[model samples]
Target: MNLRKISTNLKLPNYALAIAQDYLPSTFFQYDFKTSNQVRPAHTDIPKPNFQEYRRKPLENPNALSSESVDNRRAIMSLFSFVGGIGTLYGCKAHLVQYVLFLSPARDVLATASTSVSITDIPEGKTMIVKWRGKPIFITHRTQQVINTERAVNLADLRHPETDDQRVQRPEWLVIVGICTHLGCVPIPNAGNYPGGYFCPCHGSHFDGSGRTRKGPAPTNMEIPTYKFLDDNTLFIG
Candidate 1:
């Protein structure tokens, strides 16, 4: 068939023609419909923000305070800081003072001498053992016969040759360390072969009324410690 006859014979609707034009290839049409549908992006070159300058400038605020008000606020903060520092220092000073008062050395109490006994507590011819500085002390109230017996002892024959008078400040009160001269054993009072004296049962060491070693393996006299009469009756010992 010829072109005019084909065109007249094929009775296409207006909607059909429109649909065919939309599906036509880009080569048949000079311009692409898709390109015409796309909007060109605006060439807007937004200037880069000066972040350093923006940070340096203070932020704008309608309710911003005055410079005088800001300075007053800073002064208040400084006063609070100073007060807090002073309070901390005062607390430390209080703790230091308490430590010094409660924990300081106790040398004076330890070094002072101790009181021993009153004379009324001990009777005539009786002996008492007391502790002083962790050792036994013998405080004897001697009779006249005991004093005479001690004085009559021959110095040449005695193991420890101290005179009876030298061993005592007062002849009636004889004070000596109760430990045996030989083996450091505490001696029994008024129970030995020697009269009015101490006796060590462990080694049979005997001490006279003057605390002189009379017999057995003892080498020296019983030790005498420093003591003084506090008054007529009281005694102080170290």
Candidate 2:
């Protein structure tokens, strides 16, 4: 219906012109589309219906809850969520603690891991042997004469030289592993060529009172296990 000619003939704003371009009919029609504030005159032959007859009636909802009931439901849901989150956290913590404990050593193995001896049981100038982790540990109760003799020895004469003071925390107590340095053989206490020392009969290795390698095939002194004095009368060895 010559829509372009109609649009070009009419004077309209940019926005209104664009709308007329899209919505304008391809064929001529009787309807008038006005973009102005002026109202169109109503035809006398067409009658208007009463709005009251066409209006919808408001209906009452049978299942609608009050504000108090809605608030109570919301509060209950929030409390349930909080309780569930707290329970999950505690459950994870409990599992983590149980896993950590499962990885640790058994109680009986830990008990046998270290050895404790009463130094008062061993008389002066005597040595006592105890077992630690399936190995013999020598606990010597040195006399004043034995201590003096060990401290007086020359460091140059020993194979693996270590001073008597360096090997012991206290002069009266000498703690060492009883295994021979030459080979894995147990040494006899107070029966070596060096008096007041240990003798390994397996390889003829001699160790002085301080556990230093003397005249033998042994290359180093006897090993000193990890030890500490729990008290004046107790020795703890590991």
Candidate 3:
């Protein structure tokens, strides 16, 4: 038969050659694709329409098609905006979670809670070193005369002087932070008076009874940590 002869002549690889050879015998042989490019070659198997052309289609009919295309474009833009918003929200949530829940709280907060202390042990006019809120607090009973003595001193002789009202705590007692204002060296209380004041052995910085930075490289007044008195005899420091 002719099929057997063609199959043998083409040297076909498999079933495709068989199909291509057999399909040409169909009744639609008059049809062929009108236009084509390299990507898609025109097919030659389909037949032309049997009936003749009756009426021409209208050109304005494409308005509905273009409107539908615009609608599709709007829908795509809305979808993109929604996706962008969601991404921004997720990024904000991740940042908040890291700062509020994960990373920020990891740092140790040095507080006065563990550092505060109370004592009835120190002698009058003598200082007792107690840790309050992680810093040293020097609490002095400031004898009955200490208040009078502080008031009687000449204000002109004092470089950094404080009146009774300038003190954060009650004026009758002297409560000062026990760190040196100059170089952060702890000052000794009764080390041969520089007009009778707290003496810093490291740099010889002197602070008055009110913890005012009187002499040396100490730039500011001795910092007063938070504290309140419990009663007449006891002190609550923080």
Candidate 4:
């Protein structure tokens, strides 16, 4: 058909014919009219991701930690360490102080080697009891008769034999432990079956004016402490 007659019979606009002629291939007019139900392979080209740019970019801050910041952190740790050491030292010192205080009383008691008492406080021919080192001490001011009597005792007859002169530093003063040698009981002065002596009523042990055991179950003489005369009237006993 003539191009104008074909266009009029198809009822297509003149602009549409020109558009189809420019866009379509020359073989499009020679169709065989055969159809197949199969999916065509896609031949589209996709853009690849730029992995090199991602790898090149930095993951961290460009500037590293400053020396000043590191120094500040070290200084803070050192300060904490110093504080802990001081606290530990203070705790140890406090414990030491408490231990010293606990031992102070016993230390004071043991520090001195001697104790003094006035001789005048003990009258002549009387026995006085005093405390030394938490134990009883007997200070006897013996009369001349008592001294003679103690000196006259036979050493063979005594249970615990000791001379009167050996027991006393001076003729008038007799110092010895007041505790009975039998069982550690304190003896009553000048009140026993024996004259010018001490008696332990608990076990019936008797000590003479020289403190030598004379009667009953006592095993030894009363203990004599180390003593000396500081002056005419003051006696030092240890």
Candidate 5:
């Protein structure tokens, strides 16, 4: 064999390299029975397999998993939105709950038909405020005091005394709104310079027992909401 110079920087061959087959032991490196002892170049260890393949299951698009996950989130959100819509509707509707009670909406500004009241519930000479047609109607059962005064008023003393003849129904009964048309105020009944009628404190308006505007700042008389007698004693106002 030809003699060859060895690299000085490299580790000197172990004299036992000729006998060595397994990887060198630390304590064994001190012995020398020289032969070529160059180790094979160190090879780096391979890493574990990535799940990138399993994530992209066969027959599915490469990006299908991520896309489907996003779609599922949106679908869940849409289902929640539909449930909220129904909840909103259920929260808003109102209705009549009983013969005299109602399930009123939390919000105001309602459009409703006429409500009815039994005449027998109220008596002579007394005025009852009942809701009719969403407005307050003052139903006055002319006490003998009011009736006696009506007969006593002189026609010459009155501009429009609002006689029973002017009413659509019987003259003895007076049905008029409690609200003043001039400025939407509840008028005081049968007092303060009124002979026997509705008086509005807001504008000093006067309406006779028949609700005919008599004297006041108001342009029209106390409103007579549209109403019908369901029977001799029950009146429906709208």
Candidate 6:
């Protein structure tokens, strides 16, 4: 039972050397060595697991479901996923609504969207200029003679034809946007070839007293803004 000599001769592990040193029972080694050579139990002879223990048991509550079917579990999970997705979309929609409102025009800007002018301030046969939406608006007080002359012009002679009566909201008032249709230049009031009309110096466009394109490169008449007379003296323009 000399452990150092046994270990050196057998080339056993350190644990085997410690066992041989600590456990000096020769009977244990002898019996273990004999049993190693004898017929051992086959793998099949080992007791099989009691699979019955793993089998599902009945629910303790009489009203409870005994087992959840595969389909039932899938249905529950699908319902939860659908509800979660809808909630996420609703949350995103709320945030998008806030962003849309943030980009809209301010209340003050919308409030000042229109302009008001006193029609009485403009003398007869004269033109007055006012600004609306960053564009010049022409408010002309036409004399009866000028109106009669403009109405006398034939529609066939004009480039963009329209009757003089159609251009004015009233017979005395001639309101139009001052931008020349040819090149977006401002036209000179009462200075064109046509009497008491508009002239675009940039491209030689001529407009008559009714703001109709009488001559030059202008494709159409001067634009008329949305306006109405609140009273004989008050005019509202947008």
Q: Which structure among the candidates has the greatest TM-score? A: 6
For model 3, state the Cα shift of residue 56 in Å: 32
Using lDDT, rank the candidates from best to worst: 6, 2, 4, 1, 3, 5
Determine the C-alpha RMSD for candidate 4 after optimal superposition of all C-alphas: 18.2
**Cα lDDT tens digits for candidate 1, 81-100:** 99999999999999999999
Candidate 4 least-lDDT 10 residues: 53-62
Judging by lDDT, tell me the better candidate of 3 and 4: 4
- Each model's RMSD to truth, in Å? 15.8, 15.5, 12.2, 18.2, 11.5, 9.1
Most lDDT-accurate candidate: 6
- Sorting all predicted structures by TM-score, with the top scorer first, yields 6, 2, 4, 3, 1, 5
Per-residue error at 23 for model 5, in Å?
A: 94
Query: Model 1 — TM-score against the truth?
Result: 0.54
Any residue pairs clashing in model 5, and if so which? 15-32, 15-33, 15-34, 16-33, 125-143
lDDT scores for all predictions?
Answer: 0.80, 0.84, 0.66, 0.82, 0.65, 0.85
Clashing pairs in 1: none
lDDT string for model 5 (1-238, tens) is: 1111221223436553433425545455445434577876545655656667565233245555665577666777899999999887766543223422445543343445657788886766668887755667788877666666665556555544445445536555778778987889988876656456788888887776666666777776566667778888888776
Looking at candidate 1, what is the lDDT of residue 130? 85
Instruction: Kindly report which residue stretches of model 5 are placed more than 4 angstroms away from their true locations once superposed.
Output: 1-111, 148-163
* Residue ranges of candidate 1 with Cα displaced over 4 Å: 1-113
Report the CA-based lDDT of candidate 5 relative to the real structure. Answer: 0.65
Candidate 6, superposed: residue stretches over 4 Å from native:
1-102
lDDT of 6 by residue, 45-66 (tens): 9997665555434423345553
